[model samples]
Target: MAKFPKNFLWGGATSANQIEGTFLEQGKGWSTADIDKFIPKEQRKSGPADNLVKRADVEFAMHDKKGIYPKRNGIDFYHHYKEDIALLAEAGFKMFRISISWPRIFPNGDDKEPNEEGLRFYDKVFDECRKKKIEPLVTLSHFEMPLNLVLKQNGWLSRKTVDDFVHYADVVFNRYKNKVRYWITFNEINVLEMSGFTSGGILADNIANRKEARYQAAHHQFVASALAVKKCHEIIPNASIGAMIARFESYPKTCNPKDALANVRANQNNLFFSDVQIRGYYPSYIKRFFKDNDIHLKINDGDKKILREGTADFLAFSYYSSMVAISPDATEGEKLTSGNLKLSFQNPYLRSNDWGWQFDPIGLRIALNELYDRYQVPLFVVENGLGAKDKLSKDNRIHDDYRIDYLKQHIEQIGEAYQDGVEIMGYLIWGCIDLVSASSCEMSKRYGIVYVDLDDYGKGTLKRKKKDSYYWYKKVVESNGLIL
Candidate 1:
């Protein structure tokens, strides 16, 4: 197998909502993440909370007093950031990915002023990262939006929110411009296409057309992202700003030509997000998609110019599993599997994690090559890790060989991609330390090498301990993929 480069970035990633507790402390306002309550065991079978469906869901989440909101109480990273950074530094981390909570910076989305306490908090965190000699990769927004925006301006659905987000972007960009060199404008920005409130704080039922409103809101975000890119370049000339995507590569379930065609369509849909940001324009295929779906976007006077001028410097993405795509048939019964966003059939040959999510390390290599050959930009794997129900042994230690194996195979594939001439900037594990789950809002689905002493219902000491994978990863990083 090929070796990792000398300057390969090896680190961990955690979003503010996933790790930082004290959701309301220091004048921080409520985000969409904050309002996502935990479902009890009885209700979990029905599924996780379906928040942000309407105004009522927002009001209920905001007003519910006795609900078990686990996100509000994460691993208490707000208090343990220093210790966490030091541990990673001990493991020789070259980078650490974290998102600055927008609601923390600006209590309300449209506020004229930002919270100084929130600014001071991140200042301490970034300084700690820099002190450890670890470069910081900061995401402006990651699956979070100020709930106030939804109440006032319907989030990104309104042009006003676009300006508000840009203003928020300007404040943070200027504030941390010296500290942070690698910036992501929005985390999984394309998630807005399917999830409205989670990304954009949009309520579809309140709108006339759900699809139209979603795309229109996406247009607003595209413009906002472009404007942020332009501003970041102007403010921090040395910084590189990238656009992130939730890229789950699709596979044809069979050798049939029809299945291949269907797979092609699914893959194009996934690539559409990156194309707009990296290429600085939407592809013809997506325009055809918009026409076929009757999505007539309202292009403003200078929107096209902004998009053209604000292309991304690099492409960052999260790839966990490969999805199977097959032609729609009236007769064939499908064996479906867990997917990131879209529905798909299972790959019978691939192994699965405890969550039943199929794994394909080779698909990661293919994804890297496809992205490199198409965009020709530096790629950063910002999210790639295994989430399982990690159990603490009697000795109070975790021996997660399965996670290590999963990462080992995937890193080997990434190494192969590097040898294939793909310019990989770095690789960051999704959850370096255990925190709240974005899906179930539970600690049971643990993904961190550093385990947190916290339970699903906000119980436990909130302590941190390293697992076996921690030492293994340190060796892998120190060897620069030579040992793995």
Candidate 2:
């Protein structure tokens, strides 16, 4: 058995939008997540497209009164933190990664003062973690940006949002300076390109030039992230802030030079966010991308200095599967898998989950090496897990050996990566407790060691049950990856 370092963090990852319900409770305003309607599996598509009709449908659904808004009542985590944290402590969690909802604190994104009730809520949550000897890995913004920002300021597309985000960061950094040492500026900042509205609150469908709007919004987010890093360091002593990206490792479809070149460009395009956040500057390759796409980024004078000075302390990312990129002339009709907010060509060598996400534990090892070699910084696997449909047996036990096997394989790969000289900080499985799915917005796409008794239509007992993998994971954590 490969042994991890003594201080390696073992826990799970969840975001406020996915898990923390009470969207309109305790002075919290509506977030973009609050307005995101549940799209049926058949209605989903490969990539983002400009559709004003769909955007209007979403807006209409927001006020339809009978529309099913799943996020509005996320696993009811607002009322179950103590119970959930106790379960996590039982699993021997050394650290727990969760996001602080922007709207929860600010109500509106441009607020002069934060809501006291929202502040007190996290105060109790963080204090509970302290009681259980669990360190909280906090993300400043997770997809739950206040909808007010999007409506009033056009989301991150406008430079004014940079100051609003900084104000929110300043408040939280000062308040939780002592509780949280591990901070992430943004969750999957790279998703701003594909899912601009959900990730950064830029409504791609509403913009005339979708590419220009998305890239401009991404630049604003980059500056905001850098400013947050600077503020986090200034306010919180001994804080280590990182940038989180959705990592989609790509491989050439074949040995053809065109395929290889296409793969390289795809990887570079996906890696653009980390390049700026970690390397402290934009890559030169983006110049070609900008010119070819007719995209012009609006940059201010001191923005460069801010980005240079606020390089992230480390790099954290979520890796679910690897993708295969082919040349434009390559044949179609290949099997497809969903991941990282994009549809990718399925790898014939890998298995897949019910959600059509490819299973590739070895890809994790490959990703760790590539990221480490590129930046030479400590890497944290903050989100990695299988989303499956589990059945409650007659004996009231979830015999989810499949889930255990999935995690076991991934952890073993992490061990291999560690032996290969990667500086891995931790492995936090996605959704320690069952919560709403971020992409599908369905509770049925379950991924958790501790299962929550919630149905897809938001009707269940809300009971917490431990699956077989829960005990298995507890043992793995207690042994620090040796038991697996």
lDDT of 2 by residue, 227-297 (tens): 99999988986999999999998999999999999999998988999999999999999999999999998
Question: Whose lDDT is greatest here?
Answer: 2
- Against the hidden reference, what TM-scores do the models get? 0.97, 0.97
Clashing pairs in 1: none
Q: In model 2, what lDDT does residue 267 have?
A: 89
User: What's the lDDT for residue 388 in model 1?
Assistant: 92
- Per-residue lDDT of 1-484 in model 1, one digit per residue for the tens? 5877788899989999888879788999988898888885466653222324788888898889989888877888898999999999999999999999999999898889999999999999999999999999999999888888888888888999889999999999999999999999889877777777787788756576676777788888888999999999999999999999988788887899988988998888788888989998878888787878888878899898999999999999998899988888721787766655444577898988766678999999999999999999999999999989899899878999999999999999999999999999999998999988877788988889899988888889888889999999999999888888
lDDT (CA) per prediction: 0.87, 0.88
Model 1: worst 10 consecutive residues (lDDT sum): 43-52
Model 2, position 264: C-alpha lDDT score: 97
